[model samples]
Target: MDNLTHSFVGAVLGQAGLKRTTGLAMPALIIGANLPDVDAACFFWLEGTEHLAFRRGITHGPPALVLLPLILAGILWAFDRWQTRRGTRPEARLPVRFGWLYGLAFIGCLSHPALDWLNVYGIRLLEPFSSQWFYGDTLFIIDPWLWALLIGSVGWSWWREKLGGDQRPIARGAIAVMLAYIGVNGAITWLDNATRGTMTEPYPRAYIAAPLPLTFWRREQIAQLEDGRWISSDWKGSDFGYGYANSDQRQCRLPDLTEARRTNSQLDAFLFWSRAPFASRAADGSVILYDARFYDPRARDRFSVALPDVECVELSAG
Candidate 1:
C-alpha cells in the first residue's frame, strides 16, 4: 500500500478513539504506520532493480516491527519531555504514558506489513531471518476505492469530533467495511485460483490474478504453461462461466544466465526479485528481461531492462 493509505489508516485508527490512550498517540500511530518504509532510503545507494530486492524486506519483518515501535516510542517520549522543559506543551494535552505510547506505536507499525502483504508487490515478513517474499494477490498496489473509504471515514470522524460527538462508531464502521471489501476480493482471488486449473485444457503450471486500479471486479491474469509459454488476459468477473480471452501469448523462454547473473550485478538483483521472470532476445542481440506480472507493451521500458551484449538462446517449448 502507498504511504497515504498507511497514514490515513493510522489516522482512522487514532480517530476511532485510540488517540485518548495518551498524549502524542496520534503522531505515534501515523508515523509508526509508515516507519517500515524507512528501507525506501536504499534507493539513494542501491541502483537499478536492487531496490526491489531491498525494500519491503527487513523493515517490515518481525524484528524491525518490534524494534521500530520501541525507537518511535522513545523519540515521542523524548519530544514530550523536551516540550515540557521548554514550557511549550499544550494546555489541554493529556499526560503521556510510555507504555500506552509503545503499544499504540507497535499496533501502527504492525499494520504496515499487514497492509503491504495485501498487495501483489509482496513483502518479506521474516527478513533478516529469511528473504522469502510473500504475496497476497488481494488488492492493487494503489486502490482508489480504499483511499476513498479511508478518507471519507477520517473526514466524517473529524467532523463529528469537532461537534463533541462520539466519532469512534463511524471510524469503526469504515474499518469493518474495508475488511469486508478485502474479504470479498480475497474470495474472488481464491475463486480464480481454484477454477483456473479447470478453465481450459493444459492447465497453467502457475497463475496469478493481478488486481487492476478502479475496476475491482477485474484482474490482469498471468499464467505460465508447463511448456514455458506465458499467457496474459484481462479477466472480468462478470463473465465467470465463459473463460477469458487471452490478450497476448508469448513464448518467454528463460535462458541459462548463471554466468551473466554472476557477472552483471543488475541482472543478479533483477533475477533475485523477479517472480515470473522471462527474457526476450532483441534485434540488437541483447536480452530484454521482464516480469510477467508487470509486463505491458505500452510501458515496456518502465518494467523491463535490456542487457546489452548478453546472448540468451530462445528455448523451444516442450
Candidate 2:
C-alpha cells in the first residue's frame, strides 16, 4: 500500500480511541502504525536496495504485526501501572488502555500488507518458508478511486465530529461501505478468473489470463509457447475481445556469457534460486536480468547495473 493509506489508517486509529481516551495516547498509536515503514530509511545508506525495502520483510510481516504490538502494549502497561502508583489515576485501567493502543497499532500495521496485496505487486505473506509472491492485482498501487472513497469518508467523519454531530455512526457506516466494496471487488475477481479459465481452456497451452490493475473492465492475457517463448497481450476489454497478442516472445532466456562479471550478479543468483531467471542484453552491450520472484517483470530494473567500461574491459581481455 501507499504511505498515504497507511498514515490515513493510523490517523483513523489514533482518532478512534484517543479522542475518547486520554489524548496523550494518540501519538503512541500513530507511531506504532507508521513504524513498520521505518525500514525506508535504508534507502539513504543502502544504494540499490529498493527491492529489499519494498519486500515487506520482517517489519511488515505477520509476526512483526502481531508481536510488536504486544511488546509495545507490555511496556505501556508497565508504564501505566507506575504512573498509577505515583497517583496519576489514568482514566482507563492498564490492561484496557494497553489493549486499545495495541489493537489500533496492530490494525494499522496489518492494513499496509493487506492493501499492498490488492495491487499487482506481490507480497510475501508467508515469509521464511517461501519468498514466493502472491498477487491480488485488483487495485493499482496508487488507486485514485480507493483513495477518494477512503479519504472522503474519513474527512466526512472528521467534519461531523467538528460540528458536534455523532461521528461514530458515520464512521461505522463508512466502514461498512468499505467492507462491502471489498467483497464486491472480490466477487468480480472470482468471476473474472472463471471466465479467463473458460476462455483459455480450449487453447490450453496457448493463452493465459490474469487480473489487471485499477478497473474490473480489463484483464492482462498473454500467449504462451510462441516460438519457444511466452508472449504478453495488451490489457483487453472485460468481454475479452479487444486486444491483440504479441507474436514476439516476451519470456527471456539466460545469457551464455562464461564470466562471473555480470552487473546484477547477486540478483541473478537470487532469481535463479527463485526459478524465474531471464537475461537480456541491451544495445550498449549491458545485460539486464529479471527475477519473477517478484511479479511485474517491470521491477527487474531495480537490479545492479554493469557499466560499459567494465564490459569493455572484459571483452578486451577476452
Candidate 3:
C-alpha cells in the first residue's frame, strides 16, 4: 500500500485513542507505519531493475519487522526528552513512557506488511530467513475508494477533535468499514482465481488477479498457460469468476538462457521478480524480455529489456 494509506491508518489508530497512551504517540504511530519503506532508498544506489529485486525484501521481513519499530521508538523517546530539556515540550504532551512508545510503534509497524500483502505487488514476509514472496490480490496498490474511506474518517475525527468532541467512535467506525471493504475484495480475488484455475487447468504456470485503480469492481487477469503461451483477460468487479478471455494467444518460445540470468544483471533482476515472464524479439533484432503482468504493445519500454545478439522464439495465434 502507499504511504498515505499507512499514515492514515496510523492517524486513525491514534484517533481511536492509541495516541493518548504515551508522549509523541501519534508521531510514533504515523512514522512507524511507513518505516518499512526505508528500503526504498535502495533506488539511489541500485542500478537498472535492481530495485525490483530488493524493494519489498529484507526490510519487510521478520527481523527488520521487530527491529525497525524498536529503533523508531528509541528515536521518538529521545526527541521527547530533548524537547523537555530545551523547555519546548508542549503542556498537552503526555509523560514519556518507553514501554508505551515501543508498544505503539510495534502496532504501527505491524500494519505495514498486512496492508502490503493485500495487493498484487507481493511482499516478502520471511526475508533473510527465506526470500519468499507472498500476495493477497485483495486490493489495488492505490485505491481511490479506500483513500476516501481512510481520509474521510480521519478528517471527521480531526474535525471532532478540534471541536473538543470525542472522535474515538468515528475512527473505529472507519476502520470497520475499511475491513469490510477489504473482505469483499478478498472474496472477489478468490472468485477470480477460481475462474482462472478452470481456464488454465492443464498447465497453470501462473495466474494472478491484479486490481485496477479508481473503481473497486474491475481487475486485469493474466495467466501463463500450458503450452508456453501467456493469455490474458479482465473481470468485472461485480461478477463471480466469469470473465472474457482473449482469442489471441501469445506464445513465448523458451530458448536456453541459463547463461543469461547468470551473466546479465538486468535479466537476472527481472527474472527474480517476474511471476509470469516471457521473451520476445524486438523490431531491431534485440531479444526483449517481458513480464506478462505489465506487458503492453504501446508500453514495451516500461517493463522490457533488449539484449543484443540474442533472438527470442515467438509464435502467433494467427
Candidate 4:
C-alpha cells in the first residue's frame, strides 16, 4: 500500500481513541505505521533492480517489527523529555508513558506489512528467518476507492474533533467499513480462484487475480498454463466470465537462460523478486523479463529488465 494510505490509517486509528493513551500517541502511530518503509532509502545505494529483492524483506520481518517500534518509542520519549527540560511542553499534553508509546508504535508498525501483503507486489514477512514472499492478491497497490473511504472518514472525524464532539465512533465506523470493503475484495479474489478450475478447460497450474484500477470488481487474470505459457485474460465479477485470451501466445516461447540467471546480477535480483515471471527474446538473443502481474505494454519498460547476449532454448508449447 502507498504511504498516504498508511498515514491516514494511523491517523484514523489515533482518532479512534488511541490518541488518549499517552502524549505523542498520534505521532507514534502515524510514524510507526510508515516506519518499516525506512528500507526505501536503499534506493540510494542499491543499483538497478536490487531494490526489488531487498525492500520489504528484513525490515518487514519479525525482529525488525519489534525493534523498529522500540527505537521509535525511545526517540519520541527523548524528545518529550527534551521539551520538558526546555519548558516548552504543552500544558494540555498528557504525560508520556513509555509502555503506551511502545504499544501504539507496535500497532502502527504491524499495519505496514499487513497492508503491504494485500497487493500483488508481495512482501517478505519472514525475511531473515526465511526469504519467502507472501502475497494477498486482494487489492491493487494504489486504490482510489480506498483512499476516498479513508480520507473522507478521517476528515469527518477531524471535523468532529474540532467541534469538541466525540469523534471515536466515526473513526471506528470508518475502520469497520474499510475492513468490510477489504473482505469483499478478498472474497472476490477467493471466488475467482475457487471457480477457476470448474469454468476453464486444461486448468491453469496457478493463477493470480490481479486487481485493476477503477473497476475494483474486475481482475486482470494472469494464469500459467500447464505447458508453461502465461496467458492474460480479464475476469469481471459483474459478468462472471473471462474475456478472450490475449493474442500474444509468444509468451510460451520464452527460452531458458539458467546460465544467464547464474551469471547476471541484475537478472538474479529480478527473478528473486518476480512472482509471475515470463520472458521474451530479441532477435539478437538478448532476453527481456517481465512479471505477469505487472506486464502492462504501455509501461513494460518500467517493469522489465534486459539481459544481453543470452542463449535461447527453443521451448515448444507442446
Q: Please provide, for model 1 over 14-121, each residue's C-alpha lDDT reduced to its tens digit, 9 standing for 90 to 100.
A: 988899989999999999999999998998898877787788998999999999999999999999999999999998888999999999999999999999998888
**Per-model CA lDDT versus the true structure:** 0.82, 0.53, 0.79, 0.82
Error (Å) of candidate 4 at residue 50 is 0.9
Looking at model 2, residue 137 earns an lDDT score of: 53
Model 3 lDDT at residue 106: 88
TM-score of 3: 0.90
Q: Deviation in angstroms for 57 in model 2? A: 1.4
User: What range of 10 consecutive residues in model 3 has the weakest lDDT sum?
Assistant: 238-247
- In model 1, which regions exceed 4 Å deviation? 235-252, 297-302, 312-318
Whole-model lDDT for model 1 versus the true structure?
0.82
Candidates sorted by lDDT, best first:
4, 1, 3, 2
Measured with C-alpha atoms, the lDDT of residue 4 in candidate 1 is 96
Best by TM-score: 1
What shift in Å separates residue 130 of candidate 4 from its native position after superposition? 0.8
lDDT (Cα, tens digit) per residue for candidate 3, span 1-318: 999999999999999999889889999899989999999999789877778889888999889878998999999889988998999999988898999988998889999999999988788899989878898989999888988999999999999999999999999999999999999999988987877734644746777888878766666777765656666665332111121132222334756777978988877887788777776655554566777666654455546666767864565443
Report how far residue 57 has shifted in candidate 3, in Å: 0.6
Candidate 1 accuracy as TM-score: 0.91
Clashing pairs in 3: 217-237
lDDT of 4 at 21: 98
For each candidate, give its TM-score against the true structure: 0.91, 0.67, 0.90, 0.90
For residues 1-318, what per-residue lDDT tens digits would candidate 2 score against the true structure?
A: 678766665666544434365333554565666667666765676545344534565566777788777776667667777777899856754344666667765666677777767755566776655666766756556655557766877788789888987666665665666667667666666675666543543442444344454664455554433232333445332211112242221323444544543455444334433323333333454544443223332344454233333222111100
Model 2 clash tally, residue pairs: 0
